[model samples]
Target: MADHTIGTVADIPQGTRKIVVLEGIKIGVFNITGKFYAVKNTCPHQGAPLCEGSITGTILPSPPGEYVWGRDNEILRCPWHGWEFDITNGKSHYNPHQCFVKTYEVSIEEEEIDTVTVDTYPVNVEHGKVIVTV
Candidate 1:
């Protein structure tokens, strides 16, 4: 497995995202509730940068008669076509059968955060910035 140190936990604030380029791959790092997740920056539908998309809540169908507003869930929508994707799972809301982005394993050690990949690509966090090795 390729282990990479991405960045510090404080580099990415809650409800915010940052883009890191690694080995020609544009990665979007999001911080939600003090946790970190990394996924491909490009959207599946229109190849828009997911990092630049707006972060908003997901709408779900409520029970009949009684109206219930869905809670604020974080999602990234493509800027070009407005296709939404779950940041946690990298799944497209419009097309459940296909997934265009791949997520990497992220972990925190001391003050640094690391992003790991199946392949041997190095990634690490330093000085509040993520450095990816191709």
Candidate 2:
């Protein structure tokens, strides 16, 4: 397992996603609001391109006759059959424990310029870029 620098933050704007292929496996890096999350591109159901589906909020459990919309832009819906999954953790809304897509840890390099002490030697700073551990 290793961390892959798929692309910069700019490649996936807020409320959007960028799909990257690592070791022939498709993964998606999503920007929800400002945070980034990575998940497998294939849906657990029907092998659909999960990342290519729509990113939107889902309906919440509410009192009868009342409607509540929650988790805005934090849900990923499979285009093939509208199966919803949480993008942050890749848990299926339908059956969280039994059915779900694979999730990866996502990180971003520190935005500010800072010195890195390597072998007691200071080195140049690193730019802020999106990374996924797979």
Per-candidate TM equals 0.72, 0.80
State each model's C-alpha RMSD to the native. 15.9, 13.5
Most accurate candidate by TM-score:
2
The top-ranked prediction according to lDDT is 2
lDDT for each of the candidates? Answer: 0.76, 0.89
Backbone clashes for every candidate come to: 9, 0
lDDT of 1: 0.76
Question: How would you encode candidate 2's per-residue C-alpha lDDT over 85-116 as one tens digit per residue?
Answer: 99989999988999889998899985566788
